[model samples]
Target: MGKKKHEPPPPTGGLDQNGLEKRLCNCICLCQLVSILSGVALLYLSVIVVSPSKQTLDAEFESTPVVCTTLENMRNSTNCSVLSCGEWCISKGGSTCAIIHAKVRREGSAVSFRDCDPVRATFCSAQEYNQTQQFICSEGEDKTGQCDALDRFMDCKPIKNKADDIKTEMTSLCRNITAIRDCRGTKPDGTQEKEIHVCTRYTCNALNGIYECSTGNCKKLENPTCVDRCSNLDMGNMAVVTPDLFHWGRCRSAFSNGTRIWTDQQKPLSMYCTRIRNVSATEMEAEDCLNGTLMDAPSFRQITNYKQMLGVLERNEEPLFEDQSFLPSEKTVEIFNRTKVMINVLGCVNTLRKECTTWLAHKGRDGSEGMHPAVYPCFITPHATNYVITDYDRQATVSQLVMASAVPSCLLLFSCFCLCLCGKTVGVNEFGLFFCKPCHKQDGDGGKEPAKLRAP
Candidate 1:
């Protein structure tokens, strides 16, 4: 009987399957809601992290730059809670920050804080960087007092090995004039036969018969019957003449008149002076001739001029001449050391050259207004936006004077800027609007209204 009763374990005690499913779904719904809320919170945090607030500092100070202060001073700052509105010019690396009263009026530039030595800041120009590099690498120009020696001999090309014909002909001419009867009758012994030397060191060859000679030294004739031609005019101080001088005469076949001879019917017979030693001669002396020296050029005088030019350029000194390439002199160095204000002015000039070269390649080759940008990578100061456009226009003024020949259009743009700054009609707005200011006075009186514009 007990086994039969166990038949269907009285169907599982009444269970609420729907209610269990409903409970599970409710739990899932709660988890989804939590997940959605979490996502929304995360989105809110992300937005807060990325978007920075636009705020302005409003502290006022004199035109001097505010340098780093001590910790005590910073703690004592009353306005520490608010961002300072003064000019904050950060260095290129964003490491150093200085609050300058003067604003940076250019884009892509930062206030330079790297300490520059007096000498380096004097003649600093971007174009001269390579020159400066070379100057640094080298010890300096050779200033030693040594005479610059030069060659004293002519650079004469020697006769080729096949000049045997010229040699033979010259020897024959010498031999032909070896002996001569006293034709001048300088020696008188009444009728006795007087033997006189026709030419000294007489040499003979088949090409030319006898070359005349008088003593150990052979004298050249004005018109010789021999094949070789020699000069009748005396070559004074022949002992002083170098062998090269004679070689040159031979190469050119110089005649008695110092001109070369040429003829269609005759071969070129070059008469060159040959130095021969005569063993039989009792009297023989050695002599030397002088040569020319190289003359110094006029350009050597420029060294002195450059020194003077450099002196004038120092101390914002008005230059005497514009064309001269200037160098820094002791005076310039003195001025640089004495005045920081002047150095700042020159710094602007150096900055001009440094930034302009970057855009030179992109500008028009013709003399148009286009030029390399005269701005550099710089941080934005509080007053940067306020003065950028206006200062750019002012910079054009100086640019016009210096670079008029290079870029005329840029000069014109600069001129327009100067005109606008001086013109009464132009008015500046906080958000950078350039337009003619409205008349606040009667037609006769100048616009007397103050330019104090309200921030929009």
Candidate 2:
């Protein structure tokens, strides 16, 4: 053979070259898409970490609230599929009526299913009534409770039945009759008069300090009790706050005279009892309470001012008022349970240091008019935070949030590594993940290995 010619292997086979390039390009394109998506995810996560407190929503919303039994029963009674706005009036006829309803969950809220409760229905403002249904929002005081004959008190009055016994009377402030619980009355002669004891909100042990409800079963306990400011000239009992007499009520530092610190420059908050109950006749006590049995408030006789009262009321514990945090089963709205109440994540309450006051917490805070909702008849009921988030429950939500984002975070990291063989970058745009932006050119020397690839 005259110099056998080998023609440079025929430029590597066109089919093989084309197929390999196509496969590589497809892979690179997929990686680019994945990288872009991963980068967005990372950025989103970063933004959340540095963003406003997640508690911001919590500030205005009760995260996961349950319906009070009285209201829940109302919900069960509704036979209609589509609902209407409600006008719940505890005592109607005029502005004097105590409208009992809450904001319902909006048509599209995270927990809109809660709107199933009747208290929220028929209670929304005119602006956002359900569009599909014929909306009806009454303009003035609601009269729905009229048929029910709710005992709505326009003002508190003295008990005329007691026959000149001015010490006790009928008042919107309280309902059930109460005996002067535990205290020694002081006469003008400066001598002790009668020593008596009555139902107190807390069961206490003197040495150990105050603890739980004095009433073994707060549900059955129906007497309304509280610690009001006293005056030296006043004839009210000079009794120390005993275990049974735990402090409960809205002792807001601003509106209230905390620890009486206003008079003197003290670092703490305090209040003064200017007007309080004057003693009468009735109940008496029979106990030494030596073994922490009769625990008194810290510095009872010398109670000057509340040390710090504002933040304390906001705690998730059962509300301080007998009228607050009571289960629907607790039939009675204690004398102190006012028409106005604080609706919060804790529950519908007569007193709340935080948030504004409103009636008819028929809806959630995010509902047409939002609030921590509750419902009750003016009868006896169990006292507790049936609707408030327990400490254990409040704690459980945070971990779920962290665990929920774990999968996405790992997926993002995994995507970064996979793209490495082609091309990828991390920490781009502070949190951006960039993938291979590759371009291929037809080789002048023909396809040898492949286009020059970049490391991820």
lDDT of each: 0.22, 0.25
Candidate 1 residues lying further than 4 Å off, grouped into runs, are 1-47, 50-76, 84-456
RMSD of 1: 37.3
Instruction: State the TM-score for model 1.
Output: 0.16
Off by over 4 Å in 2: 1-20, 45-399, 424-456
What does candidate 2's lDDT look like per residue over 1-456, in tens digits?
255443322222233334544565566667677777766765665444212123322443344432222222122223322121122222122122222222221111010001011110011111111211110111112422111111111111222222132233321112211111112223466554232222211111011111112222112212222331221111111121111222222111111112211111212221111112221122112111111111123423343322222112223133222342211111222223222122222222212232222333332222221111233222111242222221223344455445435655676677667667654311111123221223322232544544443443
Give the Cα error of residue 52 in candidate 2, in Å: 8.1
- Give one digit per residue, the lDDT tens place, for model 1 in 1-456: 133221211111123223443443454445455545545544443332211111111111123221111111121233322211111112122111111122122111011111111111011111111121110101112421011111111111112222222333222211111111111212143342233223112121121211123222222222223211122212111111112222111111111222222221232111111131211212221121111111122221221221222222233232212231221122321211110110111111222233322222221111111111121212223432321110122233334433433243344445445444435543333433332334223222243433333444
Count clashing residue pairs per candidate. 31, 58
State in Å the error of residue 421, model 2.
1.8
Our tally of clashes for model 1 stands at: 31
